[model samples]
Target: MRADAKKNYGRILEVARTVIAEHGSDASMRDIARRADVGLATLLRHFPTREAMFEALLCTNLDALTQKAVALESSNPPDVALRSWIREWVEFARSYRGVVTMMAAAHTNPASALYASCAAVHSTSARLLSNAQAEGTARPDMNGDDLFALMTALGWAVDQPSFAPRADHLVHLITSTVLLGRVG
Candidate 1:
């Protein structure tokens, strides 16, 4: 991509993040084109589909999140590591509220690339769950899939309008119930 193309791509990601947050994954490429001040042809030239655009934005951020998960999980106690992972997740969710909904979609129906990328993200969560369970911090009856569902549930709670500035509370609640042995 040329410099102007890169700039347009960046603008498209920003506008797509907001538009998807407000209008959802089904939000039209035409609207995204409008918001980015690019022609529909340009938007299509850059991102051939809505999911393609979403994956572009998501892969950009989620890659950083995956790195953070690795660092945090390695350097903390098992339970603390788990909490930190959830904290990172909530941050991602708030930075792009569409994240909450997108993760749900990824669970069952994401495009191949999106699904594969999400599987990579889930690998981090699975490691945290395994570590916590081994340390007897998280519930043993649950596995990574269960933890993923719980985190997404917590994310949905945080994404609600009522959560507002206190979205972290949802992650805190989930940690207490699913990861931590006691509320602290």
Candidate 2:
């Protein structure tokens, strides 16, 4: 990419992050272009679709979360590592507003722009859950899909105004009762 083109791309991504933070995953591409001081054509040239833009924006953070899960798997106890990673995943999902819905959809759609990243996160989460279950710390009946669904549901709940205040408590309750098979 040329220097000016690369600069515009970076600027658009930066502005899109801000706009999406304020408005959510459904934030308008035109608004992002306006905020970035770039023409709509320029933004579209860089990101051909909304999913492409979101995939670019979220890739780094999702990769970081996967890496964190990997590290925790090696360094912490099975239950502790799984619980910690779940907390972090919920926080990441909440930060992006409506991202949990996209993630849930992307998890099953191979053609989605977010498919690879979401798959990586899901696989890592499954591994963490498997480790915990093997150690008798987590419920044996729960699989990776179950865990992923729970995380997304919790993420969605916490994003709501009515549930935001109880976020921490909900996390604790889910981790203890649903994942750990203990009373929360």
Candidate 3:
């Protein structure tokens, strides 16, 4: 890209992070363009779609989480690693409002820009869950898909005003259930 275009792209991304943080996944592209002082056409030329913009916005963090999962897997016990990763995943999913819905959709849509990142997360989650189950720390009946669903569900819950106050408790409850194989 040309220097000016690269600068515009960076600016757009910077503004997008703030807008998304404020308005969430449904944040308007026009608003981002306005905030970045770029024309709508320029923003569209750079991103083309909301998914493409979000892919750029979230790719770095997703990669970090994937790497974190690997590190946790090696440095911690299987149960600890799985629990830690799940908590991180929930936090990521909740970073932008309405993101959990996008994530759930992206998980099943290979054509989506987020598919690769979500798939990497799911793969890592499966490995972590498998390790825990093998060590009798997690339930044998659970799978990576189940864990992914739980993460999204918890993320969705915590995103709501009613559940936001109990975020920590909810995370602990879910992690305990995953680790102990029982609700109580």
Candidate 4:
């Protein structure tokens, strides 16, 4: 790609991220282009289709999230690492309801790049969660993916008015229910 093309691509991705993060994954490419300060023709020249664009954006974000979960394993104790992973994931989740929805969609679309990302997230999270459990840091009852599922559910729920007040309570519930006093 030429320098201008590269810039356009970056700009498209940035605008897509912002739009998707703000409006949900169903945000329009025209809106993205307007937000990117680029023309619709330019956006189409780069992305071609909305699925293509959404997949690219989702893949990038999911990769980062999985990497963060894996990275947390290298931190201090198992429980501490798990908490850090959840916090990081929540940060990613809180950015948009679309993020979690995209990820869940990816998990179901086995042939999609999003599916591959979901696989990686599942594997890494399971491994890290196992480490916490083996170390007796996590609640012995719940496994790794369960912990992440809770995070995703709570994170997703926080976007709704009815669930807003329960955000902190949800976090604490997952913590206490899953950690059982294993915060160390």
Candidate 5:
């Protein structure tokens, strides 16, 4: 990328993060471009689509979550690490106002720009889950994908105003169920 193009791209992503956090995953690209002090054409040249822009914005958070999962594996017990990572995943899923919905939608759509990032998340989640299962800390019946779905469900629930107050309790309850009474 050219110097000016790279600068625009970085600026767009930086502004998009703030704009999307304020407005949600559905925030307009034009608004983001305006905030970034770029033209719509410039933004489009970089992101192409709204989902692509959202994906780019989310990539940093997703990468952090993946890295957290990796670090927890060696730093904590399997059960503790898995549960901790799930909590982190839930927080990541709910970071933006409507990000859980966007993640849910992108999670299954292989063609979506965010699919690769979501898949990487799932891969890391699976590693944690499989490790727990192997260590007899988690249920053998549920796979990583199942855990991912359950975590996302909890994320969506906690994102609601009604559930926001009890989010931690909800996370613990779901974690207990996922752990199948093996939590320690």
Candidate 6:
């Protein structure tokens, strides 16, 4: 990419992140363009679709989540690492307003741009779950698919304005259900 084009692309993504955080995944592309001080055509040229924009926005968070999960596995006890990674996953899902629905949809759609990120998240969760299960800290029956579904539920819980305050409790309860021992 040319320097100016690359700069514009980065600016649009940065603005979109802020707008999406304030508004939602449904945040308007026009508004993002306005915020970024770029033409709508330029934004469209770079992103092409809402899904593509979402995929770009999610790349940073997903990378961080993957890195954090790996770090936790090395640094913490099996159960603790699993729980910590779960909490981080929930936070990642909650960071973008209305992202849970998008993630859920993209998670199953192999053609979606967000699919790779979803797969990476699922893989990370699976590794953590497997480690915990091997250590007898988590239930053996729960797999990566199950953990992904539960994480989506956690995202949904935190997405609601009313339920947001209780998200931590919800996480603890759900973790208890998957882990061998209660979390809270």
What is the C-alpha local distance difference test score of each model?
0.80, 0.91, 0.90, 0.74, 0.85, 0.90
lDDT per residue as tens, model 4, 1-184: 8999999899899888888877886798889999899999999988887767876776777788877766777766777777777667666677765667767666667876567767777777777778888887676777656865777686788766687777666666666666646552
Q: Against the hidden reference, what TM-scores do the models get?
A: 0.86, 0.96, 0.95, 0.83, 0.92, 0.96
Candidate 6: tens digits of C-alpha lDDT, residues 1-184:
9999999999999999999999988899999999999999999999999999998988988898899999999999889998988788778767899988988888888999999998888888999999999989899988999998998988988988999999899888888998887464
What residue runs in model 3 are displaced by over 4 Å at the alpha carbon? 181-184
**What are the per-residue Cα lDDT tens digits for candidate 3 across 117-174?**
8899889989999999998999888899999888889999998889988988999988
- Candidate 2: the clashing residue pairs are none
Any idea what lDDT model 5 has? 0.85
Q: In model 6, what is the error at residue 31, expressed in angstroms?
A: 0.6
- At residue 167, give the lDDT of candidate 5: 82
Q: Which candidate leads in lDDT?
A: 2
The per-prediction CA RMSD against the true structure, in angstroms, equals 2.3, 1.4, 1.8, 2.5, 1.6, 1.1
Q: List, in order, the clash count of every candidate structure.
A: 0, 0, 0, 0, 0, 0
Candidate 1 deviates by what RMSD? 2.3
lDDT of 1 at 112: 50
Residue lDDT tens for model 2, 13-48: 999889988999999999999999999999999999
- Give lDDT tens digits, candidate 1, residues 1-184: 7999999988998899889878766788899899899999999998887667878988978889999988997798888888888888877777666566666777556555478667776778989989998999888888888888887877777777787567666667788887757544
Q: Judging by TM-score, tell me the better candidate of 3 and 6.
A: 6
Residue range 1-184, candidate 5, lDDT tens digits: 9999999999999998888778877788889989999999999999898888878888888898899888999999889999999889778756777787777788889999989998898788888989988888888999978987997888888777799789888888988987855553
The C-alpha stretches of model 1 lying farther than 4 A from their native spots are: 18-28, 108-110, 180-184
Off by over 4 Å in 4: none
